[model samples]
Target: MSKLQIESALEILLQSLQSNSVMSKTFFWNYLKVFCKEGFLVDLQTLSIALVEKQAVFLIDSIACLDYKAAQQLDILVLS
Candidate 1:
């Protein structure tokens, strides 16, 4: 990816990390994959790598899906 794309991905990832809620591994991983492919996330593997490369405390730093607003903001995406 170009530098700009990579930067954008990083920005998106950081934003997501800060604002998006943590999802189940299966759900979050799948969502992240698409975002990465779409150039919305840089170093997509960072999620999984964070699991193994870092300690449990590190992985525990993740947010919960309940905290994610993006899903709720989209009427079609929200189930309820």
Candidate 2:
């Protein structure tokens, strides 16, 4: 795979996936296979709830699929 494709895959995972739930190892490993055809790997051992929240925050800031009013409501809920 090209560098662009690898970067695109990682961006999608880091920006688009949900955060308010469990992340199966299989899910990540599957995507890893698609982008990393060689020796690359994800450091699963370093994952934590904080990491999930950080990713969620990134997803929220991107505002890719949210309705404006709904996004506002969610922001309120998150702050609350």
Each prediction's RMSD over C-alphas, in Å, is: 13.0, 13.9
Best by lDDT: 2
**In candidate 2, which residue pairs clash?**
none
lDDT, residue 36, candidate 1:
39
Cα displacement (angstroms), candidate 1, residue 33, comes to: 1.5
Task: Encode model 1's per-residue lDDT on 28-61: one tens digit a residue.
Answer: 4565556535643233334333333332222222
For residues 1-80, could you state the per-residue lDDT of candidate 2 as single tens digits? 34444345556566434454456444644554443344222322122122244454343342324234434544554555
Error of 1 at 8 (Å): 0.3
Number of backbone collisions per candidate: 3, 0
In order, candidate lDDTs are 0.39, 0.41
* TM-score of candidate 2 against the unseen true structure: 0.30
| Whole-model alpha-carbon lDDT for candidate 1 | 0.39
User: How many clashes in candidate 1?
Assistant: 3
Model 1 vs. true fold: TM: 0.32
